[model samples]
Target: MDWNDRFAASGPGEPGPPSVLVGREDLVPTTGRALDVACGRGTVAVWLAQRGLVVDALDAAPAGLALGRAAADAAAVTVHWIEADLDEGLPVTGGYDVVVCQRFRDPALYPALAGVLAPGGLLVVTVLSVVGDAGGRFRAEPGELRGAFADLDVLVDEEGGGEAHLVARLD
Candidate 1:
């Protein structure tokens, strides 16, 4: 995915935080380094920065990165926006205190996501699901989130309303 193309195509004021992540403060770390995979306009990334975590926000879109940089600057926090093709996999070099992957589904990257968490780090993810909607290849099935993150200390695992969310802490 060319992030620049997507950003160029966007017609909006600014992107807001993903709805699924709202009211989920417990799933985020209050300090330490964080990573936002496939960070599209950076709403979540900026939110994390506001929460006091230094963030490395990755996206394929240049325009989105620009928005994220602006948001970080306005928030008086630092966020490193890296333009990356998620298809090549997450470019996360250092383990993070918190890792957030929202609205981007890739079963192949599941293990990689789990691998990048520090021992006590948090992993919060939301992906399209087939729970209440017609089944599709990209949608997660019932128990997918729990089954995938079974080793973690799961705080919440909800699969319904066409979405699956998992908030877990690495042990």
Candidate 2:
């Protein structure tokens, strides 16, 4: 189904922060410009905003953006909701202290994601992977994240159970 229809069909709920970042708050700077790529329903965006970061949440689906807006309002936080197709490329460029792309995999955009970060900025990414599971067209091969982000100072790189996650900082 299309993202707009899929998001519209989903019910409202507090989706909260990304699992990789839940208890690792100290790894991220509390105050800085942050971007949440493919930020469905704005869960992480609002969470980051509440933590004092100026957050920009991007998603292609208007329905998702609407739900995210409502959720942010209910949480008493503010986030800039951007509507753009990520396949075309990142809509904004540079100066972001934190860039998060969770549960969204697009190898073509990996460079853009890294480029958007400021020096010393942090990058958090999670994607489906083939490790310990049946390989699929959508899943990353083993060591994909590690190799793709090798230029950065990797703080966390893990792959197992059909998932791959990376947290790195640019020098």
Q: Show how many residue pairs clash in every candidate, following the order shown.
A: 2, 0
lDDT tens digits, residues 1-171, model 1?
565667657633243445655776666667899899988888888888888888899987778888778777777778889999889987877579988898888888888899999999888889999999889888999998889889999988888899998988998
Among these predicted structures, which one has the highest TM-score? 2
Looking at model 1, report the run of 10 residues with the lowest lDDT sum.
11-20
TM-score: model 2 vs. ground truth: 0.95
Candidate models: Cα lDDT each: 0.83, 0.90
RMSD of each candidate?
2.4, 1.1
lDDT tens per residue, model 2, 1-171? 988888889955584667777788888888889999999878888888988899999999899899999988888888999999998999997999999998899999999999999999999999999998899999999999989999999998988999999999999
Worst 10 residues of 2 by lDDT: 11-20
Return the TM-score for each candidate structure: 0.88, 0.95
**lDDT at position 168, candidate 2:** 97
